[model samples]
Target: MPLVSPDNSATSSDEIMRYPFDTMRTVAATILSNVSIALSEHEIAWKKAQDYVQSLPDPLQPAFMDVLNKHQQRIRDSYKWQEDFAGALFNAIDTVSNTDSNISTSFQKIDNAKFTGFGHGHLIVADE
Candidate 1:
């Protein structure tokens, strides 16, 4: 899998001083967006999943949004259990299902997003 810290609390706030809640919210939103894309893409190119996913990177990504951006890059790389895709896919599924919440969302937030499946409002919104 990707190099995840065992704690998984986003412990590394290397740049958290400059970017606060906004960074977190943006990262959360982008990750959710990608999961949606990957889920849809999964059905579209189930057979060529590897090719379809590895191509996600090489696109310009902001530095503050490091989590989503790097996570995407990792998804494109190959691993025996297809760790990258599998990790993203599993996280997406878990967040959706609330199974083992690394990121948790409430129904009120879902209502806030108008149930549109975007901008769930569970993330911190700060930074530049």
Candidate 2:
């Protein structure tokens, strides 16, 4: 099956195909934004936890600090994964968008050529 039909109905079909990608891109961007906010909150909480551990007596602080450090590392790792995921999602969106644009442009050129004889010596004019 062709990516787009010669008729203009393909315009709507193109839009239909583009909808999901656009929606996914929007959702991914929103999720990434929320993740950033959550990461900031995590930093604040981690700092608070560290402060609380430091308030403990010197003998009690070391163990609590160690635990906090381990948990912070885990949180950082999780955030890194999320950042990587967002990067991947954005890349995919960009690739799809470029492909979609190229397809649309090609289809438009084909449509124009139908009326202009594809730049051959013979020209076909369309009736308005």
Candidate 3:
């Protein structure tokens, strides 16, 4: 039957079918490597925060996750955390890309901006 067909011949002829598990393997390796860097104290406090989060038992995980959430937001807020995150992120990418040609990551900062306005002098003064 001469019916609807695809020119997948050109694109897919030489291409290997990458299963979901393949991408997951790369991502998992990257995460683990980044965590190792984190424990070495080279990575940001956010990394440590992640360690704390992941170490928690599955049942009790979500409750204390707020602090990690805030830490990530604060990384956006602070220049220092931004720098640390950049370095660690790049290092992991480099390691993966160099050893494995299939894996690729272009680490680039889109923008780093602290949210909201400055201290409005509407302070509740401490009554000494």
The 0-to-1 C-alpha lDDT of every candidate, in the order given, reads 0.47, 0.76, 0.53
Higher-lDDT candidate of 2 and 3: 2
Q: Taking the tens digit of each residue's C-alpha lDDT, what string does model 3 give over 45-113?
A: 657777877898987667668766766656545544544565665566565557455333212111233
The number of residue pairs in model 1 that clash at the backbone is 4
Cα lDDT over the full model 3 = 0.53
Candidate 2 lDDT, 49-118, residue by residue in tens? 8888888899999988888798889988888888788778888878887888999997887676637343
How far residue 2's Cα lies from its native spot in candidate 3, in Å, is 80
**lDDT by residue for model 1 over 29-111, one digit each (tens)?**
66666766775675455445444445556462233245544554565442323435545655564454453332334444543
Candidate number that wins on lDDT, 1 or 3: 3
TM-score of 1: 0.24
In angstroms, the error of model 3 at 26 is 41
Clashing residue pairs, backbone N/CA/C < 3 A, model 3: none
Query: Which parts of model 1 have CA positions greater than 4 angstroms off?
Result: 1-19, 47-128
Estimated TM-score for each candidate:
0.24, 0.63, 0.25
